[model samples]
Target: MQAIHKRLQALTLLIAEDDESTLKWLSRVLSIYFKEVRVAKDAMQALELFKESPSDVIISDIEMPQVDGLHLLQKISQLSPNTIRVVMTAYNTPEYINIAVESNVDFYLKKPIDIDEFLVAISSSVSKGSILSEEIFLNEDYSYSYKQKLVKKGQESIKLTKKEVLLLELLLKNRKSIVSIEQIEHSVWQESVSADAIRMVVAGIRKKLYQGVIENVKGLGYRIE
Candidate 1:
């Protein structure tokens, strides 16, 4: 049971619903528990918000004017797999059921959502994994020794710093793609992360890991090999 903090608060929730009334009502209800709530009038808005900064959980309706819930689910999976996703649909079709299963959504509910069920699902999801203890690894043909906290390249052992170790674990979880600097700082330091700080730490890790251990995109973030 984590209290409502910036890191664990219902801190931010992304809700995609087209109906004005329902959206307002949901925002009101969720605001009571969460410190910040962002509402998307349609799927496109939801996707944009998600891309900007992923939410702790996503609750979206199936039907929308722009993209639709199913497409949103697919995008979320491809872009941000760590987000806990839930879909709400009035149409209970076999197709949707299959999609939900394939998408591996946290839960699916009919329209006119039951708040209690939603709360239960969310609570269980939060407790399922220890966010602090996750490991993020690269897809290289390298062997990792976690207990030893070493990575072997040929006959050499690469020693990582405390920050490097934490950063590496987070990057491994987000393998093959850019991990947002925001996520890295918040999760690792439990404080605000500055670009200068991230650069210093990343440079240190790269120097130890390999010549080109981490790839830094201009506008994006870090990706490890």
Candidate 2:
């Protein structure tokens, strides 16, 4: 629990369960470690809260009114591709597993959830949140090392500030996809930031990486090309 607590304390989580007793129990367990835990009675409510305040991890029950877990996961994937999705349900059928996999859920936990396994899954999800890959090529001269979180061109290493590193990582994670200013503020700053502040951060990153590495989609957001 101590180890799990450390790994989850900084993360925000959402749990959707139609059963009141199960919801209360899960919320209590999750609140022990997670920084913020939001609960929803059904998938629709979960989606609403998720849109209002995106969460690092989303744990949802497969069976729910209006929108089921699989449908919710699909919507979430479109809304926030980086969010970790988990499905917890009593149904342990092959069809459910196949559907969950197709929906891109990060984890599937059968009801009567094992505490240890659930903790491990959550920890793994947190680790996966990092945009690290084998390598990401920024340009002909520069490549970003996901493991090192450094940019390199030949033998020279281009230094990046902490904020710059976060910004670059976020962009690379969503490479070629538009990342909204709101998403940038939430993921990088972890709080509300002025649009001007986000622009300044982007400006600083552009200066380091070169102007065209990041493209500003006017009125939309930013993307890495």
Candidate 3:
């Protein structure tokens, strides 16, 4: 359980469910594993929140007011294809299943939700979602091999230092949201470090890569666009 919790701790999740009791209960349970959890009563509200700030993983009910989960998932897929989408519902109708499949939902859980299965599904989604792509092209010249931790620009290839690689990995993993300084320090340094130190490290990475590759959120932290 501890290992599972740690694995999920980095993810931010959005849950859309119209049932008040179910929403509250699910949110409370999921909050234990995930770093942040946002809840919406309907698909429209979920879509609005997603547009405002996208989540790494989305777990939505199949039926909701205004728009259904399939429609919401479709819009979200178009907006941010990398997001891990999950659908849950009591209805096991063929039409609902077909729609969910067409929406490309990562997981479909039956409602009267099994806690163990739900956790496993979410954990798997978070782990997979962390890697947005096999390779990330920083620009026309520079590209990063996420699996190899190698940076390439044409024929020249440079291997990132352990710290730089870790930093970049962290940024990419939480690409959808601003990773706070505290979180960065804990993840990268594994201890208390000065904010100035963090800034210096980021600056060095920018120098090695390119300017504007990483965006600083003022006092918050950093994010890779």
User: Which number leads on TM-score?
Assistant: 2
Q: Report the C-alpha displacement of residue 182, candidate 2, in angstroms.
A: 8.6
TM-scores for every candidate against the unseen true structure? 0.62, 0.68, 0.62
For the record, the alpha-carbon RMSD of candidate 1 to the native fold, in angstroms, is 8.3
Q: What's the true lDDT of residue 115 in model 1?
A: 75
Clashes of 2: 0
> Each model's C-alpha lDDT?
0.72, 0.82, 0.80
Off by over 4 Å in 1: 1-10, 130-201, 204-225
Q: lDDT score of model 2?
A: 0.82
TM-score, predicted candidate 3 vs. hidden true structure: 0.62
RMSD of each: 8.3, 5.6, 9.6
For candidate 2, what is the TM-score? 0.68
Model 2 per-residue lDDT at 152: 93
Candidate 3, residues 1-225, lDDT tens digits: the string is 887787677667999999999999999998988879999999999987776566778899988877888889887775556678889999988888887898889888899788778778767755665435557777758888866887888888877778788788777766657777766776678777998888888888888888887899998778887
Compare the candidates by lDDT and give the number of the best one.
2
Ranking by lDDT: 2, 3, 1
TM-score of 1: 0.62
Model 1 accuracy (lDDT, Cα): 0.72
